[model samples]
Target: MAEKEFENKVALVTGGSRGIGAAIALRFAGSGAEVFVNHRKGAGSSKAKAEELQERVALMGGRLTAVASDISSRSAVKEMMETIGREAGRLDFLILNAARAPFKPIERLLERELRDLIQVNYMGNIFCVQEALPLLEESAGKIVFISSLGSRFFNPAYPLGSMKAAMEAVVRDLAESLRPRRVTVNAVSGGIVKTDSYKVLRQHMENLDQLPEHLVVEAEEIADVTAFLCSPAARGICGQTIVCDRGMSNALQRF
Candidate 1:
């Protein structure tokens, strides 16, 4: 119905089978980008969600391929990138949107659990970036990491917030290193979003009523900001964490 913004670009979105990742994949494809949608396990894992998205892309006359891989593994990430290079020729955008964690209290979290969190959320990101750097450099691409407000504020429900904080540091460091190469790196920290992940905390949604209707961020909203960051308009805006929390971050706290 409308002109697409990223007509010639090729994008790779990790964990894109559903929720925020799904929204990002659809948005990029809608904007005319050839997208590589990465997911782990089989289609049976997410069922019709992956097929639904693939069909949507086809209907829009956009190119997309859904691949399955465990990003926490270095060899898996390497093979994924190799496939993209061979098929897409070059990569123009990377969205690290996949993460895993178990809800537990800080003291209750096992050392093994912490290690798993680090591997999936932090180390997985590092591996993806490193493997994709060559193609990204060739295209002067944009890399967007999907973080959360938990990285900045205390969320007792999610003991894995510390890993998000670590990722914020990674974003800054990577941005600085990639500056000379013309590739931009940034993190999008979203507030409470309505997604399958949020279903676990739906009980708290009522407590958020005091905030604006828009304050409850949606997956698509995050997708929109992410797409903008990957565009030419965001070329000068690098090494920054853009908070898409609908001003929730600015509200004064009550004692």
Candidate 2:
């Protein structure tokens, strides 16, 4: 509950260039955590924007490092972990926020689409956790995987929902398995975050506009919850998916 509670702690946030990941990265930096903002850079990637973010984060008081690695690649993840270990001997927090997917109907899913879905959404996170284990073990690190309402509430066109749901299960499983080691695992299933992803999602789901303004979840709100989960105050909580949707999940089927 004190200011700069994360002083000297090390945190890694995937997809931290913008949106919820950005909010989480800034939150950690502002709280005095050394932040590593990780992004994927290649064709059509936001390498420029990510670099700009790196510059902005460096201006903050906390130590900041902008890293680019394809989470889907085992070698890339290994290299990323090596860099972190070389620079900072330990990692205190690993926020799983990066997600790459092509939103489409499940029925129309192609072989390539399915493979990528597993690679980027599911296996990608697995690789991060596996690679981060050593550094995290050294520090008893906290892990928070960002999820969405689609994981629970069915979205016909939201193909990423399945992956989100799968990670939540992983969170629960790892939370118990790693408890003896002092590591914590949890998930935050946000609702209707109006980020750039939402813009793309709107094209697939028309009902987005119909949701009440009060039901929307903000990136900063998600960031704060995530920060709390990583803090000592939340040590009592684990293996849970905290919903931050302004009661939106209960708002449906209104009279």
Candidate 3:
């Protein structure tokens, strides 16, 4: 693809301050799309990381807008979409990558944790869709939710899996429901990627250290797949969760 394959396009990547979200934001910016990097408001580190990403993009002669908004708030999500519309005029891609939850078993979750799990992971994404629908419909946009292997295969102490599973269902429903409007929705369920969160996960899932090196998935690898999903090459695909696990999920031994 050309460097400017996505020139004149606009993309919003929620939770784009770090990890896989950061990678996706950079991917779109590198492809000549005006990118919005969304980080939670009041998160100093996250905001700083987003600024760093913005600087990096600027060095590449690309534009990246760092928007601070908490996806969990309906009002915040609406304002975010409005900001995008005002600044970019149109939105072509909405990447749902924000997630908040403790690394604990479902049984051990506190009421607040459970509320956050549902509100941020599941409902927060729904809020983004609801708010961005108008701008998306205007551009025949694409929505890609970031999911995980834990959603399908149970992982020890990973409470976010249930929300991932739920959102995958939404992906399918939205794909069909919004088909007439030409707005496609899909998901990317990544395998084990060594992001900052992996350090914490390693403490709970000892097996992560024992997994074969070849089974590890890189953040950039996931970004590449996401870019493809939004590209014309993926026109035939819709409402599907494309797994980027390096085939690790295919081997039963990993479980």
RMSD of each: 2.2, 1.9, 1.3
Candidate whose TM-score is highest: 3
Ten-residue region with minimum lDDT total, candidate 2: 42-51
**Candidate 2 accuracy as lDDT:** 0.89
Better model by TM-score: candidate 1 vs candidate 2: 2
Model 3, CA-based lDDT: 0.93
* TM-score, model 3 to reference: 0.97
Q: Tell me each candidate's TM-score.
A: 0.93, 0.95, 0.97
Tens-digit lDDT string for candidate 3 (7-88): 9999999999899999999999999999998989656787788889999999999999999999999999999999999999
Q: For model 1, where is the 10-residue window of minimal lDDT? A: 202-211
Return the number of clashes found in candidate 2.
0
Ranking by TM-score: 3, 2, 1
What residue runs in model 2 are displaced by over 4 Å at the alpha carbon? 1-3, 42-45
**lDDT (CA) for every model shown?**
0.87, 0.89, 0.93
Clashing pairs in 1: none
Better of 2 and 3 by TM-score: 3
